[model samples]
Target: MTILCYHSVDPAWESPLAMRPGEFADHAAWLARHRTVVPLSEAVNRLDRRGRLPRGMAALTFDDGFAGVLEHALPEVQRHRLPTTIFLVAQTLTDEGLDAWWVRTPPPWPLATLTVEEVLHLRDLGVDLQSHSWAHQDLPELDEDRCERDLRQSREFLEDLLHGPVPFLAYPRGLHDDGVRRAARRAGYSHAFALPEGPERVDEYAVPRVGIHRGNNTRTLWVKSQPRYLDARHARRHVARTGRRLLKIG
Candidate 1:
């Protein structure tokens, strides 16, 4: 099974994380035709249970609770009738118009975040809301106690808001270490996700995701949707980053 990570979808925005509405629509249509899209929980459950995931199984996920998702991405998702999930920074739910760390202090353009009512509206639209962490801080950089606290607060707030269990997490900035993973386990998340460059050992707590960006077309999207693509990309990036670090040390 494959899980995809997306952040924003806007026509005017051209950042690495923002995808044009047309591109998103195309990707959604491609997935609709090529894959059996399922809910995030179902994919994770099958992975956890070691059950055989159906052929062409995939899931859609958005991170950071961006409002563009509701504006642009939602319609495509609805048109395709795909099940989706959004990982939210818990603190941002109550803080409308508050620019997240990425959008603050010299952001290229205003990046609007979703409010509580808006999130509830998405929930009404059948989108599962999960945690991206309390403050969207880098978990790997925090102490064990602080990391656990942040993760717990994120889950607690979302569970309260959603009136159900919030069992999944997508690490802030796709960054995590062993201690951070332990903190997530202690914080009670059944699984967590990172970008394609995640740790070598793939498990529930460090699932690799294929991040969809502005430049993705049908060809790139098809390549990314493969079941083996995630691990293979992870291996390549891990080696590349490790080499860079070794060179710096030398």
Candidate 2:
């Protein structure tokens, strides 16, 4: 399954994470023509089975519940009738400011998050909303107790808001470790996503995803979506790790 990840789809800010609305529409249009884009749960379930999906099977996932996703991205997704998942930072989803912790204090242009009402609207529109975390803090950086608490609390908050089992988690910043994965499983998430690269991923809890960034247009996305490219990326990463070990590079 090619689980493609996206963040904000807006024209307001140009970020590595931000893909312009038209660009996203182009990507979605291509997927409609060429791929079997399923919901995140379906993708995870098929992944658990390790069964072969239809030709060009892909899934669309978004990290951080950006307002632009509802405003811009969903229209394209709706036009294509693609099943999509948006992982929400619970605190941001509920906050008056409606922005992530880091984005609240920062530096760049203001980061936008989905309003509580918009989140409910998304649910009404049949978009699957799940957990990112209570806040967008990096999971691995926290202690185990804090980590588990964060994961559990995030799931709880989302379930409370959406009134459904928040069973899936996409690790904030795509950051996770063995300890964090253990915590996620303990916290009752059936699946967890990471930016790991490879077929031989660490475990089911650390499912890898290919990120879609501002630089990726239709052609680049198709290239990145191919198995050979993903396999080659994994091969290169393995070689790099081996070299680092041999050279004692920290």
Candidate 3:
């Protein structure tokens, strides 16, 4: 099964990486026509039992509780009766505004984020809410103490708001080290999503996600769904980055 990750669904902003509402609608329509869209929990349960997913199964996930998700994405999701998981930063839901990481860009680009009320409303609409982090910091870069605080505190805040446990988490920037993974496990997360550039074995922790960014459309999405192509792409990127680092050092 392939899990597609999205950030925002707004088209007005020219970031092709963020799927526009129309593109999202089309993707949903395609999925409804061609794939079995399952909830993340059910997918994990199946993986735990049989070590394989049913044919044609796919899952949709959104990282960050962007306002555009509530405004644009949810409607399309609901229209298709699709199941989706959303990873949210608990602090972002508060009135204090988005973290610096999500807002490092110039004005208007970083201005879109969901309010607390909008997040609650999305919860009411059957969206599976989960934790991102407290301040959207890179978990692997932080010390153990900071990592633990961010992971546990974010989950605690979300659970308190929703009155239930939020079992899933996506690492900020899809970054994780051994300590980061350990921290997530300690925080009681059932599963964590990583932007690993391809599909991965659905373990109890560290499930891989195919991040959909600018320039991803039906063709690229289809290519990413295949394990062989995805693995090759990841290898290429690894080599490219290594070469760049070597050049810098030289």
**lDDT of residue 226 for candidate 1:** 79
**lDDT tens string, model 2, 50-124?**
322344788889988988898899999999999999999888866554456544223276667888899999999
Models ranked on TM-score? 1, 2, 3
Q: What is the TM-score of each candidate against the true structure?
A: 0.90, 0.89, 0.87
Candidate 2 TM-score, true structure as reference? 0.89
Q: Write the per-residue lDDT of candidate 1 for residues 142-183, one digit (tens) a residue.
A: 999999999999999899999989999999877888999999
Clashes of each: 0, 0, 3
Cα lDDT of candidate 1 equals: 0.82
Error of 3 at 56 (Å): 0.7
As for lDDT, the candidate ahead, 1 or 3, is: 1
The order by descending lDDT is: 1, 2, 3
Compared with the true structure, all predictions reach lDDT values of: 0.82, 0.80, 0.73
Which prediction has more favorable TM-score, 1 or 3?
1
* Number of clashing residue pairs, candidate 1: 0
After superposition, the stretches of candidate 3 with alpha carbons farther than 4 Å from their true spots are 48-53, 103-110, 198-202, 227-229, 238-241, 245-250
Per residue, candidate 3 scores C-alpha lDDT tens digits across 157-195 of 999988888888888777776788888888878778777
Winning candidate number (TM-score):
1
| Residue-pair clash count for candidate 3 | 3
In lDDT terms, which candidate is top? 1
